[model samples]
Target: MLDIFKAIILGIIEGITEFLPISSTGHLYLADYFIKLNQPKSFINMFMVVIQLGAILSVILIYFNKLNPFAPSKSHQEKEATWQLWLKVIIAVLPSVIIGLPLNDWLDKNMTTWQVIAATLIIYGILFIILENYYKKRTPSLTKLNKLSYRIAFFIGCFQVLSLIPGTSRSGATIMGAMLLGTSRFVSTEFSFFLAIPTMLGASVLKLGKYFMIGNAFVGNQLAVLLVGMIVSFLVAYISIKFLLRYVRSHDFKAFGWYRIILGILVIIIGSIFA
Candidate 1:
């Protein structure tokens, strides 16, 4: 029962942080550091990656019609546009594949510390504030997904490489990069959502594959814990996705930037006292 409760807590954390400009993995790491689940290290690692599948499913369900190229209700033009959008997503994910695959193990081993997370959270937080201020003086040039060129998409992917670090939120990096490349908040946010579909799915697959290959098998109750976490995360992530889409329409991400900064500092202070 306690393990189940822990799963619920972790699920809520994952769901809330996964899509926001906040780092989900960073939050999860902190949760583990403080709450120390009574699960094996291997199971814990797999749980973190695999539960992301639930978050990914939420995106698919929410964006079903828009992302579906073969939706029977769509006209030829709309269908073509959907396909083009997917092509752009593919181009944007290439850089991460090229870079993340090689460094995945090393990053997992060396960079999952609170210090690293705190530094990234604060640094990116400041970047967000500075960029938002700069953009206020100049109107965004690219306001729509169709207007997002392939080259720009690729560059956004390159920025995603920055998110290989633990605390650098994938959505945050890509959205900021898109904005830097002259895209509007709505477009940048939406593209980040699209980019997450492939990026996270690939990550989940790789983690699952590695887990199984390493002779790790689900022990008693572990499977149940995994399912519970995924389901809860899916439900919460669905709500989060809706809220973020609505939020971005009327607001910039300065609030999240400030949040990242404050949270990072608190983590550092807490770590120091606890240590």
Candidate 2:
């Protein structure tokens, strides 16, 4: 029961931080330190990634109104709009699939190492600071998905692939990438949120496959924990998404960038002492 309670806290952290450029993995690291999750069971090791599926599902549920994209559009233009949005998302996801699959092995071997995590966190955090200073393209919100250029879509996908390095953050990389390419911050952010559903769900499915192949006998209980975690993540993510969209409308991401730099330094320091 105590273990279950700890799992709940982890799930909440996952949901709240996963979609933000704030780095869910970093927060998980901190949460683990606080809860002493360093000495983890096999399932517990994968538990963080597994819990992210819950946050992914929250994207689907909360954005169901748009993400559903199932019904026939009332007009020809609407049909084109739907297809265009999907095409962009597909373009954005493809490069990651190509790059990430090959890198997965390398990442897994080095993932738990402080050296790897520290380098990725510090390097990417610095990039965040420089990238945040660029101009914010004020693309009108009315500019629907169909209006997005193919080059922009392709580049966004390419940008997202950089996040294969753990701690680089998919949201941070993609959103900053889009902004550099002249995408308005709001549009880039919304597109990143839209793109996250398929990207994250596919990754989760892949992880689930590996979990079963590893042949854990306690699979049933782990699945139960996963379901509980997913529900918690979904609830929290729905709220976070709403909060961030509104917050970004009025403010810049300077605060988040500063936050990443501070936290990255903290992670390196604390890990040196305790890791």
Whole-model lDDT values for every prediction: 0.91, 0.76
Candidate 1 lDDT by residue in tens digits, 101-150: 99999998999888999999999999999999998899999988998999
Native-to-model Cα distance after best TM-score fit, residue 208 in candidate 1, in Å: 0.5
Candidate 1 deviant stretches above 4 angstroms: none
Q: Evaluate model 2: give its TM-score.
A: 0.89
Clashes of 1: 0
Query: What number of clashing residue pairs does each candidate have, in the order they appear?
Result: 0, 0
- In model 1, how large is the Cα lDDT of residue 132? 91
lDDT at 107 for candidate 2? Answer: 82
Error of 1 at 240 (Å): 0.8
Which window of ten consecutive residues has the lowest lDDT sum in model 2?
A: 136-145
lDDT of 1: 0.91
